[model samples]
Target: MAVDDSSTDPDGGSESESSASGPSRSPSDSVSAVARSVADPILEIRDTTVAFNMDRGESRVLDDVTLDIERKEIIGIVGESGSGKSMFASALLDAVVEPGVLTGDITYHPTPDESIDLLNLSKRELRDLRWEEISMVFQGAMSSWNPTMTIRGHFEETLDAHDADYVAGMERAHELLSDLYLDPERVLSSYPHELSGGMKQRALIALSMVLEPRVLVMDEPTAALDLLMQRSILKLLKEVQSKYEITMVFITHDLPLVAELADRLAVMYAFQFAEVGPTETILRDAAHPYTRSLLNATPNLDADVDEMKPIPGSSPDPVNAPVGCSYHPRCPLATEQCVEQDPPFFDAGPNHQTACFHWEEAAEEIPFSLPEQTDREASR
Candidate 1:
């Protein structure tokens, strides 16, 4: 299980402080244990919380988000629109625009003794880190690219910012375009509006990879596209991951898509992670009520589409969220205790955990047969 530290609620109380006082082992201990087990961890986001200051005061967008990202694995962050998935991605690069304050620590460890605290880095340092060590592919191509700038212009701007060689930058651009199955000459000469949506998205990805960043953070990389286009992009993404071995953080609202691509998944709701675990375990036997609800609500192609189950009630307001477990308001297994105190992430199984207080009961109520082991292994 993960720990939440240096993160407080809107009421000024530390959310994980109470858990530390419990008789269980310390959260740091658990984190260390997991750290020792993994061969390589590229990024460690510990108890990270982001709050935006609004006219109505401060609104907490992300609450105590903690997770360890492996060196060469794809991590999918799934949630509804207002669940703070984008905020968490922005916080990773310390790129949350303005009027937002981030607390806790986001450490990037390229090596064992070289743990760099991203939140404490100076502006100059963060700029250097952006494209070299980490890069982000924003949601839409229209918003990500400047209309007046040609694809080549965007590449020139990015390379120039990093003080890289212009000739090498152009060469790398062509290389990436070929990798994504785009015509280098045509794409380089075209403006943002001149290209199709899928082409523009491919260009955006190529731009992010120009610097060969080790970590790629993508926010809805395949939104606003047809099924064929989406599949093409997904196939390209899988190829990119295998070839470059770059660790990726894929953020999206689509659970099934993530399950197909990512090795692990984190289900976010009410500005917090309802469940975080291996994708197979999560899909087959989700321990949290919210996770189960999301799977149930998803459109299952294998089963009848009419049997879809939608979760009741809208997400809670970030400014004035409910006390205790945020999902207790809508969770079918919610008890009086669940509504009174926040539940810490409890261990459910190997490399899996849930923030539900009554996970056993919930698991029993929403049990699912695991997919075939051979198919699961082949997918991974």
Candidate 2:
């Protein structure tokens, strides 16, 4: 549902501005968002766009995507199934598939004066960056493994591809697996079919961390796992990050999960971000109606059943989304202006922003005090 920063026609701009989006092309341009003092900017996406050509017309899946990843930051992208959350992270890692065109500036400031434009890189160059510089733990970890290869061999093969020797790599892999609470010998020698779902999940994470890259992009790493497995995996992931100092981009539809892991969050809808800011402020003090609906729909353990808020209607059609405000049709506070002119992303605070025109007026209702909840009261 989305494309990365490398292949698309960016917004409100000429090709000259976006030439840097490609790996081989560097634009003679500057951006206000760029900060040279930030030595650890693992990646950045500016005005990224992606489109899918269909019989009807070109469907814009991503519109002006931007990324500013610093060291050790856990950024969570939350949205519905088709919200293009996956596309943003996938594109950042240069793991985008074909037929999906990406356009925009993706600057990876790997070294000062030496930025890697993922969009312009050759396929081989992109592939090289995948395992060695940037790694991913995809949604279905078990399926990603090979049934034909032994777990030990599979892990070794992954490391071997990066020119890492088997003996030393295996030792490191063993250590990582142990850290994830998996028994080294049995897990290494077992086939993919032999290992349980959770074990395979941990093993997938182990492989991603085996290289210990600077940025680790995970797409719903706990999607189908049980609560116990989810907690176990999250705990292990935190531990590994502490040891490796890996930056993370967690792509999922779960908000509570964001609260637990993310330092900042960005909410996307119909291929664009509705809001982006600090997790606590955005969650408790959201300004956009879309974000408010999402927060309200969160099952409150303490709220009475009738007091809960339910989001109205489904997302707009991605193929031909609304012209002005993408969420206008379903937004409770939508007006004539919202239906006529698309609201630009506006900063609400130091590191907070919302794309809603009524941000100021909507803030109070969005973060109402519900007095006290029975869940917390009883627990105390």
Candidate 3:
């Protein structure tokens, strides 16, 4: 998966639209295609919610997020900064801390016949699950590493914690770093601060894969890196995914970067999933207004400056979300029904689902068009 330099704008802006256009396909068609294609699911998340006992009150960070992660596939979870993308990733590993209440079924299928509910596991059981069955490459490689410890020490610590064979684990680490195009000997001997940002990121990725977990959750793997480094990391991730046959849950806000790597895209807004579907289907024809707005807001190389429109307003306060639809205040197709009543997941296409009452209307509207009169009144 070679990332085209032109896919991203020079200014480090977000997602870009695909140039190839085909005949219009209804959202319903996409739904069916996805259902038929995704036969094997590794993780089944149902009504997963995360809330904090804040001083102000209970603040919901993740609200009823439900999705099926297929085996050996790359799924991109894209959203704004406070949209609970990272929280959702943490919940997968049961890593949420004190004052944070995480509730819901996160069923992991270790085998076709065996299923384990991660949230129901005991502390010891959950600890065993981490790094062995499910591993995570957290955001910000520099911060994730301990400046005092060498890279070799990090691997040794993880291996020792897991009771893995020391010699074999080090061998695995060397192989992974070499595969990632890093000098294993030097990287292993170097401290966190000794390596560059990109090197640290690649090293972090190598460390995460040393265990060879069945599932890998990467939160902003390429953050704070230059365009070239970002591209290299994306390409390396694709290779890793192919070589290991690992199921990856990629969390990032950069749609274009995810678009290049993911087989499916899950769009998050206001701590809830706005849309989930195949990458090409969502990119070509988004059913949710928020999804459409995000695509419209993306900077396009061929389009004029005026063509790029930022999403109006900001994400709603999680502590005090809007009455009905969280996005109603900013959605162009929002209606009185949207404001007063929460919308359920509607079938937009084959395997595609969106939480929007006016999905049909959104599908018919042109991208980046001005908001409707009702939207203006709702915002006011």
A best-first ranking of the candidates according to their TM-score comes to: 1, 3, 2
Error of 2 at 121 (Å): 1.4
Q: What's the TM-score of each model vs. the native?
A: 0.88, 0.85, 0.86
How much is 336 displaced in model 2, in angstroms? Answer: 1.3
lDDT (tens digit, per residue) of candidate 1 on 1-380: 12332122332301122233332222224354334324577888777888877776778888777777888889899987787777888888998766678887889986656899999989899998999899998766446678898999999999999998899888989999999999999999999889998999888888999998889999888888887898788879889888988899999898877777888888888777777777887888888888888878887656576667788998877887789888888888989988898887765665666777788788677644333552335655
**Candidate 3: tens digits of C-alpha lDDT, residues 1-380:** 00000000101111111224622233232223223336787887777788876666668777766667889989999987777788888888998776678887788998768899898899888987989999998777558798899999999999999999999999999989988999999999999989999999999988888888999999888888998898788888888899989999999998877887888898888777788778877877788888888878876655677888898898777677788888889877777988898776666665666777777778677465432332113323
Model 2 lowest lDDT segment of ten? 8-17
TM-score, prediction 1:
0.88
Scored against the true structure, residue 63 in model 1 reaches a CA lDDT of 77
Give Cα-based local distance difference scores for all models. 0.77, 0.70, 0.76
Off by over 4 Å in 2: 1-40, 111-113, 367-380
Candidate 1 Cα outliers beyond 4 Å, as residue runs:
1-37, 367-380
How far off is residue 178 in model 1, in Å? 0.8
Evaluate model 3: give its lDDT. 0.76
Q: How many clashing pairs does model 3 include? A: 13
Best-to-worst order by lDDT is 1, 3, 2
